[model samples]
Target: MEILVCVKRVPDNEESEIEVNADGSDIQRDDLVCSTNEWDNYAVEEAIELVDEHGGNVTVVTVGDDESEEVLRRGMAMGANNGLLLMDDAFECSDGKGIATILKAAVEKGNYDLIMTGAQSDTGAGQVGGMLAAMLDYPYASLVNSVEVIDDKKLKVGREIEGGNQEMNEIDLPCVLSIQTGINEPRYVTIRGIRKVSSVEIPIQVASDLDISGDSVGAASARVKKIDYFVPELGAGAEMLEGATEEIVEKLIEMLKAKGGLK
Candidate 1:
C-alpha cells in the first residue's frame, strides 16, 4: 500500500543550545545547526520496509525552509520513491497544531493507504501525531513498536506502554501510526543511493498553495504559553547511615516509607 511518512528538520541537539529569542518567547535558531529529527528516521525506515514487502511506494514529506530538503534527501536515499518539501515563511513559526493541520492537508492531497510519523518531534510540543490523525479523521495508534499485515486490508500493531505493558491493536488501511523508538533499526544511506537523490529536485508546496491559514498557527496562535525557562538546582549530597546489613536495610525501608516511596 502507498504510505506517506512525515519527517522534520530541527536543530541538532548535539550542536545546539536552547536560548530564548530576542522576543523572549520561543527558542532561537539563528546560531543553531540543523539536522533531521532523529526519531523520524525510524518512520521512514518503517515505510520503506512496508512498501518493499507490499508492492507500493513511500513518499516522505517535511515542512520547513529549503534546507529541509537535506533531510528529505536522506529519506529518499533510504528507499523512499520520492519526497515533498512543504515550505513557506509561515511554516517557520508553526506550533504543533499548525504543523498537524498542514500535514492533514498534505495527506489529503495524496492517495495514501497509510501515514506514519515519529511519536514526537524533538523540538516543538509532542502533540502533532495524534492531532494530525484527528484532523484527518483517521484511526491512530501511538508508540507503536511492531506492525504486521493481518490481512490484505488490515494491520495488527503493538504499542509500548508504561510498566512493561504492551497494547496490541488492529486497524484497517488508511490509518495513522506514531512509531516509537526501538521499533526497528533504521538503515544508513549508501554512497550510491545518496548520489542518486542528491541533485533530484523534489516538489514544493506553500501555505497559499494548500489554502492554509497562517493566523491559525505559531506562538501567536498557541493555546499554551511558556512563562519562562530555568534549570532546577540540585540538592546537597545524599545522607549515609553507617551500620550493619540488617540495620541499614531497616533504616532504608523506614526512610523510603517515610518519603512515601512505597505506598
Candidate 2:
C-alpha cells in the first residue's frame, strides 16, 4: 500500500505538570519527558496492519528536531518499514499552514498511496492533516475509525461525526485520513526492538532540500501566533472532587442532592 504515517514527539502530559512558559507562546519543556503522540500510535498501528495484509510497506515521518528521531525509531520498532525525519531550524514556531507546507513537501518526496495523521496532537489544533490534504489537492477524511481495502484503488472508510454517529464512505487511493484513537490496539514496542532498528538509516530533510524558502516558513511566516497558553481558571462556586472512583461518585451524589439536582 505504500502508506505514510505522520507521527510526532510531545511531552508526556501524564508525567509532567504542564504550564505555560514565561513567554506565554509555548509550554515549559526543558524538563519534560517526551514520547510519541498518543493518537499517532493508533495511526502508526493502523498503517502497519494495513500494509501487513496488503503486501506493502509503511513509512513513519515527523517534523521536529534531532531528538525527535526516537519517535521515528519507535514507529519502526512497531513494524513500519522506514523512518523519515524533517528537521530544520527554519521550521521552528511554524503555524498550522506552515507545518502543513513542510509536510506537503515531504509527502511529495515519496510515492505513498495513503497518508495518515493523528486526529489531533497535544496542541489540539488538529489542522495538519486537513491542511496538508488541501495543499496536496488530495481527497481527505478526518476522525477515521475504520478503513477497509476494497481493491488496490479504493477503500471503505468510517468516520465519527457529531452525536457519535458513524458515517461510512468510499475514498479513492492516494488520499489522506486523520486517524482517531481507539481504532486499534497499538502494539507494544520493547526496548530491545527499538535498539534493533537503531542502526537503520533515517534520512533527514531540511528546508533547502525541500525547496522551501526561508521567509515562506518559520515564525516570521507564521500567520497564526500563540500569544498565550494557560489553563483556564476554574469558574465561581466550583468544588473539586478528589479520591477513588467510588468516593467521587458518592460525593457527586451528595453534592447533586444538596444542590437540588437530585431528590
Candidate 3:
C-alpha cells in the first residue's frame, strides 16, 4: 500500500502576519518564513503511523516554491520514505481548483492507494482537499480526527462535527481524507532522521510535465469565485465588573439574560 500525504509550508503561527495588498486581492509579503502547516504535520504523522503498522512506503508531496521544499524535508525527517515537490510559477496564483488539479495529476502519476491532506490551509481558501477529491473521483472525508485501517482496503475514521460531536464512518481505501490537527500529537523530527535523509534527492514535478493547465482548472474556470477579501474592523473591548462573588454572579446572569445568552 503506497500512501501519499500532501503537506504544505506556511508561516509559523507565532511569527505570522498578514499585510494587506493595495488591491486587497492578496497579502503583501515582506519577511515571511516558512514552516510546515500545523495540520499537515499531523497528516504526515498519521501517514507515518500507517506505514509503520502496515508494511508500506509513505511519500510526502507538496506544491509550492522552492522554499516549500522545507516541508517535504520535514516530512522525510519524520518517517516518510520519499518526497515529491511540485514546484512551478503558474501554481503561485492558483485557487482551490487549480491547486487540486495539480495535486490530482501528481497523485495519478503515482497511483497511490490513499491520499491525505490537512483539512484546510492556513492561507487562502480551505477548499483544496475537497476539490482534489472531486477531481480524482475519490470518496472524501473531512475534519478527520482519527483513522484506523480495518484491512487492506478499508478505514475506520472519526471526524468532528459542529457542537463538539464526532461522526465515525467506515470508508473504503483509495479515498481522500482532509485530516484535522488534533488527530495526533505530531512527533518532532529527530536529529538522526534529519541527517539520514539530508542528502536524499527530492523528486521535482512540473506542471508542463503533468500536461495540466490554468485553462483546465484555474479560478477563472472554477465553480466558486472570491469576489473580495477584507479585514473586518476590530470593535470594542469588554467592560470590567468588580464586585463580591454574589454580586458578580448576579451581574453575569443579568447580562446573559439581556443578551439572550440564557433561557
Most accurate candidate by lDDT: 2
Model 1 C-alpha lDDT versus the unseen true structure: 0.86
Q: Model 2: clashing residue pairs?
A: none
Residue 73 accuracy (lDDT) in model 3: 92
Per-candidate clashes come to 0, 0, 0
Best by TM-score: 2
Among all windows of 10 consecutive residues in model 1, the one with the lowest summed lDDT is 228-237
Residue pairs in clash, model 3: none
Ranking of predictions according to TM-score: 2, 3, 1
Give the clashing residue pairs of candidate 1, or none: none
Cα displacement (Å) at residue 90, model 2: 0.8
Evaluate candidate 2 by giving its C-alpha RMSD to the native, one decimal.
1.8
Could you tell me how far off, in angstroms, the CA of residue 135 lies in candidate 1 after the best superposition? Answer: 0.7
TM-score of each: 0.83, 0.94, 0.84
For 133-173, candidate 1 gives per-residue lDDT tens digits of 89988999999999997776899999999998999999988
Q: Which stretches of candidate 1 lie over 4 Å from their true place?
A: 15-31, 235-263
Tens-place lDDT per residue, model 3, 200-263, is 8898988788887757655455666667877867557666778999999999999999999997
* Model 2 CA deviation exceeding 4 Å by range: 242-250
Which of 1 and 2 is the better model by lDDT? 2
Model 1 TM-score (2 dp):
0.83
